[model samples]
Target chain A: MNIIVCVSQVPDTTTKIAVGADGKTIEKNGVKFILNPYDEYAIEEGLQLREKFGGTVTALTVGNDSSKDILRTALAMGADKAVLISDSGNSDTFGIAHSIAEYAKTVVPDLIILGRQSIDYDSFAMASMVGELLSLPSISMVSSWTINGSSITAERDIEGGKEVIEASLPCVISAQKGLNNPRYPKLPDIMKAKSKPIDAVTGASVPARVTTVSMELPQTQRRGIILNDSEHDITELVRLLHEDAKVI
Target chain B: MKIIVLLEPSGNSIKRSSLESITAARALGATSIHGFMYGGDANSAQIAGEYGLSDIAHTPATEYSSTAAATSLAQFAKSESASAIIVAANAAGKEIAPRVAVKLEAGYIPDCVGLALVNGLIQGTRPVYAGKARIAVSATTAMSVYALRPNVFTARKAENATSVNVRTFTPQLSESDTRVKVTNVIRNEGKLDVLEADIIVSGGRGLKGPENFHLVENLADKLSAAVGASRAVVDAGWRPHGEQVGQTGKTVSPNMYVACGISGAVQHLAGMSSSKVIVAINKDKEAPIFKVADYGIVGDVFDVLPVLSQKIGAVTGK
Candidate 1:
């Protein structure tokens, strides 16, 4: 089996986001960036698949020089190789998917995996986008999957239930949370991965079909009312929920 | 401009989210709104007419395949000369819309919270950084695809009875296009999923242990709400991952969100800050959940939950 896992870096979820000077992006000066949490599961799943099928797992990403950090983490987690397609354009989901699909064509991997969605954009569109670009079968939000010969069976969540899906090899899958517990990189592997060579290629200059015109913080109109848990307070809260909030 | 709305069938009727997509499409002031679906009869989908849909198209398929559906939907939109396509941001929609956009060479915007027409061009407002920030976006492509977030747009019914023109659409599809298909569906019977629930009662570490989750469940049952959990309790194996609500879990915007014993981490807030009303109960008065909550009660869950449950039951007559 030949597997390719796509990964990316995102601002830590806890970071306080602010509008950038450009007014269309987030401020990066004081924010902390980390490997996207969902991608860790994708990398781990790819490594597990390689272990069971006896093939190589390659980690791929599209970003600038800083994205190499995530590929290093993937290497630490047992990926056989890392590739970075350098691009500076942001807010372009289609452009990024095209870049990854272009890279996957060269390797001709049996399986391609990614996180269900990136935390920053939260579009949840990459797997199907890349699958369409490559003309391959794709599944998203896969929580559990089993491989039998060339056929893959997976379970994914929907609006109120789950669906058991069947697909063939040479497919795309986007990992959802609870898929698996990702393994932590050890100190020795971390040291070895730091020196691993990363193949760099220039990303294709695909123009963004979607563009952000402005950005702002979400305005809060929540009425902050605090009370104690006394019997009187409980009654009052219920009353407010019925009359003021009108939710109950 | 002609707009196409992708519809999903739920047993007999169209899914509420898809109806909301029709509502979103209507907001664009399009010349016409057409409803399309992957596998279902046109008769059962006639209910979409009440939601401002001018026409409905059904293409029957035995199984579910995102690629095949995208291919067919994109082709239908092209044949109709649609300027935009609207779909609900459900699991299947998230998977299919982008592929349709790729095939049509259209710009796709996912999880939009608001939509407007500015100078006769449709623009969208979507949340990024997990609802911490909002951005206004537009399509550079002539054709655009927008996936409206579930539960945000209200599905309004037209005052007058409107007739729908229903038709069966046949598109050219190949074997390779539908290589992936849904073989079986597993339903979590009798449980309200947090993602679609209007009211959710979530428990946290302050509930002490799995044994104490009944308090939360009882409260949820009395209030007719879904049971949810914080990451701490979920990681501690006290609750299932499906019920977890946080950044890494599920994002919800229920009408009322009740957080019990949760400290309201930034990631947790990110998942649910769009909720219409928030209520928090915690022993530590300074827990972060109180800040965003519409109403809060400062007390231990053990002491407060049962009383709250009984009072709610009394009011709801449950």
Candidate 2:
């Protein structure tokens, strides 16, 4: 089994985001970047597949030089190799998808896995686009799975419920959270990853169908109006909801 | 411009979120709103018309299938020359929107909180960096697809009469297109899920144990609200992942969100800060949940939950 896992670098979930002067991006001066939370699941799943099926797991990502941090992290997490499609375009979802599909053509792996969505763009488009480009079956937001021969049985969330699905191999699986607990890299592996060579390739230049016009902060919530344990506060709260907020 | 809105069926009527999508499409300068139902009854068509749909199209769809439906919607949009395709940012929509974008070779923008038409282009503003900032995006295509978040846009009265023309279509499909089928669906019998619920009562680690979640469930039952859990509780195995509400969990924009003993982590807030009214009950006065709550009661969950549930029950006569 040749398993390929796609990952992305994003602002740490805890970072305080600020709009850049350019108005089309975020200020990254003090913000720390980490591997996308969902993509960690995909990388871990790839390693597990390699362990069970006795083949190589390759970690792939697209970004500029700083993205190497995440690729090294993937290497530390037991991936056999790390490939970075270096591009500074901050390309739209379709452009990224085309770039990944361009690289996928070279490897022709048995399985391709990625995050359900990137936290930054969160467009949730790449895996499906690659699947469509390759004419392969694709499943998104998979939380759990079991590989059986060439057929993979997966379970995913669908609105109010969970659905069990089965699809053949040579498919794209977009990992959702709670699939598995990703293992932390041991000190030795972390040290080894620092020495591992990263393969770099130029990303395909596909024009973005969606262009960023600008960015701004969302309306901040005001300080809450805290109510005490008094019955009057509760009664007033109910009245305010009905008369003022109108959300009751 | 012609805008196609995908309306999903719920019971006999269309999903309220789909109506909100239509409402959103209308705001995008749509001259004619085309309602497309994956599968539904006559009642859905009437509901669509009430929500500003000029015409309705019904297509046969398998349970939880997107491939065939996406292929057909692409054909419809092409034939109708739709300027944009709007869909509810719900499970079915998210699952199918990308596929539709791929098939139609159009731009796909998911989780838009706002949209508009400018210079004959569809523009969208979506929350990014976990709701801290919004990205303004303009689709540089003749046709684009978008998924609208629920509970944000208000539905307006349709200018036309209640009656509208409805059409049906059956698209040809190959076995490979629909190789993945939904074999089984697992959910809380008869209860609403957090994503689709108007009211949600969520518990956190402050509840102490899994058994105490009964306090939340009891109140949720009384108020006809869905039961939700914070990441801490869900990670601790106090609740299932399906009930988790946070950045890595689920994004909800419910009418009312009740936080019980939750400290309101940034990740959790990202999932539900869009709720219309927030009510937080926590013993700690410094709990972050209080910062965003529209109404906050600083009290012990063990003492306050029972009283709150009783009060709501009395009001609801449940």
TM-score of chain A of each: 0.97, 0.95
Residue-wise C-alpha lDDT for candidate 2, range B108-188, written one tens digit per residue = 888888887777778888988878788878777888999888778777766874677877866666776777667777876
Native-referenced Cα lDDT, model 1: 0.91
Whole-model lDDT per candidate = 0.91, 0.84
Q: What lDDT tens digits, residue by residue, belong to model 1 across residues A115-141?
A: 988899999999999999999999999
Candidate 2 stretches with Cα past 4 Å from truth are: A221-223, B39-44, B62-64, B170-175
Docking level for model 1: high
Q: Residue A212 CA error for candidate 2 (Å)?
A: 1.6
Alpha-carbon RMSD, each predicted model? 1.2, 2.0
- Give the lDDT of residue A132 in candidate 1: 93
User: How many pairs collide in each candidate, listed in order?
Assistant: 0, 0
Q: What is candidate 2's CAPRI-style docking category based on DockQ?
A: medium
